[model samples]
Target: MTSLLFVDDETKLLRILSSYFTKKGFVVHTASTGEEARSKLRDADARIIFLDLRLSDATGIELLQEFVPRYPNKLFVIMTAYSDVESAVTAMKAGAFDYVSKPAKMDELEIIIRRACEWLDMKQENRTLKEKISKMMQDQEMIGVSPAMKRVFRMVERAAETDATVLLEGESGTGKSRIARMIHRWSDRKNQPFVSVNCAALPEQLLESELFGYEKGAFTGAHAKRKGKFEAARNGTIFLDEIGEISLPLQAKLLQVVQEKSFMPLGSNQTVHVDVRIIAATNRDLKTMVEEGLFREDLYYRLNIIDIFIPPLRERKEDIPPLIEQFLDKQRAKYNKPFTLPPELIDRLVEYPWPGNVRELENAVERAVVLCRDEQLSIEDFPREIRHAKPDRPPSDIALDPTKSLPEQLESIEKKLILDALEQTGGQIAAAARLLSISRQRLMYKMNKYSIR
Candidate 1:
């Protein structure tokens, strides 16, 4: 329920307002003095506050200045008996949501309160929506808006509309997994689960069990019956990441499942039929693997029904600006910090060759955000590696010098790298962090440790 607080020096006015608001389905509290009002405010969960300008000890405008900053979400309305229209305008400028003269109009006050409630609800909903979108984007695990990425997005949209198996091929960190998720989000099964299994992270037997669950006694450590990725992704999308890493035997089994849309558990005699849409991703050359007789050609054909190839970060430098803006907005909201990037940094970012692709860029930005100390992110906030990154320099120039007593040389190199990255990323901490390949929090700690101002 919405709560309202009324503060008035006149006992009758306070009682009447409180009763009226309470009768209109609001939980109302009353205070006759500024001190009393403050105390009540501290104790109650009030969403809307009515402050009397003629408080016994303090002016409503003064209270509003103090209150507004403390409770930025709460709506405040000022009331005054003095016929001074100037005071009301000043109160409004001081953060009062609205103002009312003494002998309040019940209808007008009710309308204002309703509007305030709606405004508050909208603010909360917008915050919630932004958070949800942020989370979804973060999970995609890629960042960029370059032309290549735009093409990749178009492919994802097209892939989502059909039930065809999609094969995402790209170098590691090029955001193959992210593309798979994009397809899932845009597909008809968007509301359903999107289960992911890393093909390279597990051994053959374990991988099999993970993809097609086993009975409780299928293996030594199988303590209970389990549901595998295929089952988990029933009526949804199943992402097979690093598909090139699976063994020959496993590949055959996977092919059978892909063709037949059914599989039996490792130790179970019963067959499990499932309706799962396959979205496989790999960083290796599947054609080479097939020619070497390591991968099943049939499986490749099955998954290649709709193929999407994401370009590395070096290939699409144009997307850096939007990605930087996206990351900066996220960091600012997350850290509750106010910092902006300069345009010069964008030029530097576009010039760099991101070997690690979009993932690397995001890490760099995160680093800058945490390490930045001033209102504006400057070149000084970046990591040492990124700051010192020179386009034409040999790999040796970029490497840390082992000759000059490791510590001293390392510090010198660190200082240079941070400065260079900051300069390149245009003072975006998050972007700098990505360039440095470190967490934003870690970057902040190092900046403090080395005194990299």
Candidate 2:
């Protein structure tokens, strides 16, 4: 139910307005003075507020200015006598949702209240949608078709079907967070909130208060009770990214919530129970941390109920092609350009060792797209590091005679090119094959026959 607060100095006006709104099925709360109104606001989660301009002790515009910034989400409407048009205009500029004249028509007031309520609803919906979109964009899909990736996909599919806590383990930039979101998206709780918290982003005190809300007067400057992410994500999934970064004490608290499904807010005696699933991802080795006494073994066991490990880009060269295509499409749409990556350029991309993994590949693609002028992208569009790549010239290139047989000469050139690609790519066979404009299998066969390392 939506809460409404009305503040007016006139006793009769306050009673009449409050009674009328009460009959309209709103939980109406009234105050006869600005002081009383501010006090009531502290206790009430009012979504819309109505303040009279001609207050006995304070100007309505002053109160509006004071409250708007503090509670920007709450919709405020100012009321004044018809002659007080100037004050009403001032209130509107100060963030009043609307202004009403004294002795206002009941029909007009009802219409204004209805519209204010709608605005509040739409704003809340937009906020929720934006959060979801931000999470989705950050959670790039797991891109790989290799056996390793296939195994990870199978684990993800199984994990998505259950409510068990999932612990994603992998090196930095290996898309652990992406795997977490995919699990949430495929779960039955997909329609609910997917709240993510970066355990390493905040200090321990702030992080504690964030995970478990604080009551009003709970601490200095905590003037009002705030809902924590766990409560906000009721019946949803709460992804604790960088969970390993949290201190041991906080980890115990988190484990309690995971096991008991309840937590107490800071400075509050009562416990708040919630139905939230926890998905944690980390680049650090938790087992080592556990052995080193940095992480709790019990919590580690609980979170590792279902483990999904994301392989790094260097280990899965087979996935680079698809990832490049996906990133190119995304970049083209973002930049509003119709660009196609040349096959040769993609081949060069496949040969590069992406130290930063898929994220580096994405940034490289975006950079190339921005630099590209023609519809077809070339090697020149790539960064200087990639464009200037060249293999070491073999001694045969200088020593070969021009009088050799055509087939033998061609074989010599092929061997030299293959060797050069292999050297440039740090002996990565798949990358070398891509540079040679041939399938990995064919390159492997040729390498075996030619006795190439």
Candidate 3:
């Protein structure tokens, strides 16, 4: 249900609007002061707010300025008096969803509310997409056709079918977090919220409170009771990225949630039961941490139920060309610019040892797109490290023809390289992976991904 907030000093007006909305099947909340409205906005989890132009505490535009940024999830609708209509324009400039005259009829107000909710949702979705494919960060879009990637696919497929606790193990930039999202999308809980939190981003106590939420007066600044990520992700999935970074104490708390499916908010004995699937990803080896007495053994076992390991990019050089092509396509579409990669650049990129894996590859691509203006990108357009790095393999013949797309040309070269490595190594996976400077697991996956076997 969409919660609507109306903040006005007029008690009679608030009472009338509240009654009307409540009768119209909307959850209506009215606040007579700015402070009260803030509390109600948090408590009601309001998506849309309507504030009068003049409040006893502050101007409506001032409140809009404060609320819009703080609650990116919520939209504010400014209600300005007809005489001082200029303030409404100011409110819109301050990121207000829409402005309305003081004497808006019930039907007109209803129309405005509908449009406001839709606009807010659209903006939020676009922001999410940009964040996902920004290249510098994590998001879905796994590009690989190596045997190493095929094994990953098989594991992800198995994990997605069940509501089992999944632990994605890999180094940073190998796309562990993205694999978690893929499992969620494939699961029955796809329609529900998929909340993700970086366990390493927050300190121990704060991280605990964030995961479990807190009751009112639970601690300082606990002005109102707040629901945590677990609660918000009820009937969905909660991805705990960098799970191994959490403290031992928090690990025990997390263990309880996994076992009992219930947890207590900070400073409260009352336990809240949650029906959320936990998807954890970590770059750290929890077994070593457990042996070192840093991570809890019980928690480790619980999360390791269905482990999916992602190999580093260097271990799967065969995947680079497709990844490069994917990035190029994304950048071209994003900037609405035509981009072409020269043959030497593709050979250089594939030969360079990508220490940062796919994440580094994306950053390099984004950098080139930003600085490049020529018809085709060359070695000069890439980073100094990439441009100067020594190749582990011979240069690929990716540019003998300019007609093929990046992926097509890349695939042709990758196939030839794999064929040469296999023939040179007498069909040994380990030796082939080493000669290619990729992991054995990745080599096997790539064999399956490319039908190299």
Candidate 4:
């Protein structure tokens, strides 16, 4: 049975309420003074408290302020005379769940209790949902200890502290979109909506309408008015992924929004203003595109205000072990099984160049965990691409000596690889640079350092 405490200075009224509620199948408790009510509250287990607005020793608001913060799970309903309705409203504002006028009707009190119980149940469900979301985010948090990732983390922290436009530039599968969300989650607008739109996912017309809402009859199939991402993300964030794919015309429109914080909807003269933080991501080099006259120089400059470049997994191989562990932990929790990896497996994975970056590594780990019935993950359990993958340079090509220090051995391998690339390209610097996947300037620097003729 639900428990309730009725606090009133009138002994007769308290007795009447207590008897009525007890007969109605409630576990009822009563107190005739403010001091006695406080004592009863501390000892009695009650979900609802009926507090008289004007107690003999203390006002209901005073006791309410003391109790609500202390016992946030409990409900307090104010009992006041009809003439004291104004004070009862003040009590409600002060944290009383509801108010009941003196000469309280049995039906009315029952209705209030029903509503309060429903509210408490809804609150509990919301709390549980929030807990689940928090756990998921904690499990999928960014895992990196490499210097490259540390620099990214510091930039993310600084970006989260402000509402600047952030442009995340990195190769595909490097978690640029995830970093965008991290910025939003840690920003001041964390409680607000975080809207994401893939500019490449839709065509120009559709993408424009999706971004800025259309009025009725504005477009061919415009049956009714629709709110766009900007309106939906009011006072929050909008992540535009694959931003470089946007058409030049749409780029101009987007540039206006970025510059003025306002945009006109498709076929609509009226402009809709929005207060939103824009975070854009792309795998392409916007600066190169700007110089090539493909992308607008102005828009590129605007979005590059807080540019963050996320390095690919191959460049940060030291972070691979921790990333693998994080992915394994998530899979283990999901499958409710222990999965072990051979130490040699880790070494091979670290040596392999992850072309698809973190996403590929995570997918490989998940696949291994799901297929390994013996609880020991092996390279064979992973995709063929990962298992058969070879290091960038073969040890046979370097003829590495075991006596040399690790650094010297690595330098020998690098120099040998450069020499081979130069020979294959007929000593053409540009072609060799392309074959090595290094800039011409970088390859030239290495040639000078190694004194290659």
All candidates: TM-score: 0.55, 0.56, 0.57, 0.58
- Between prediction 2 and prediction 4, the one with superior lDDT is 4
> Model 4, residue 36: displacement in angstroms?
56
Per-residue C-alpha lDDT of model 3 across residues 1-453, encoded as one tens digit per residue: 778999999999999999999898889999999989888977887788998878888888888888988998887888777786567667767887666677778886887777666767867755644443343224435766677876786687678899999999998999887788888876899899999999989998789888999999998989999888899999999999999898877888899999999999998999899999999999998999999999898999999899999999988888898788888888888988888897778877878888888899999999998888675787788899987888686675445668888887778788788889999866755457668976545667778878887
Q: Provide the lDDT at 387 for model 2.
A: 76
**Candidate 1 regions with alpha-carbon error over 4 angstroms:** 1-145, 392-453
lDDT of each: 0.82, 0.83, 0.83, 0.87
Candidate closer to the true structure by TM-score (higher is better), 1 or 3: 3
Best by TM-score: 4
Q: How many backbone clashes does candidate 2 have?
A: 0
Regions more than 4 Å wrong, model 3: 1-140, 393-453
Lowest lDDT sum, 10 consecutive residues, model 2, at 391-400
Residue 328 CA error for candidate 2 (Å)?
1.0
In candidate 4, clashing pairs total: 0
Misplaced by over 4 Å in model 2 are 1-140, 384-453
Q: Write the per-residue lDDT of candidate 4 for residues 1-453, one digit (tens) a residue.
A: 789999888989878878888898999999878899889889999889999988778999999999999999899999888788678767867888777778899877887787677768867765654563454359475766677876787688789999999999999999898899888987899999999999999989999999998999997899999999999999999999999999999999999999999998877899889999999999998989999988999999999999999999999999899889888888888888888799999998999898899999999899888777688899899889888888666455446588999999888889999999999876866457768976555788999999997
Model 2 global lDDT (CA atoms, 0 to 1): 0.83
> In model 3, which range of ten residues has the least summed lDDT?
131-140
Q: Give the alpha carbon lDDT tens digit for every residue of 1-453 in model 1.
A: 999999888899878888888899999999998899899989999999999887879989889998999998899988876575578778877888766676878987887788679879978865654554455467634454455665676677678899899999988877788778878887899999999999889998889999999999888999999988899999999999999999988888898789999998888999999988999999899989889988889998998999898887777777777777777877888888876888887777767777776677778888888888776777667767668777643456656566778788878888788878879866655347668976445666778887766
Q: Best by lDDT, which number?
A: 4
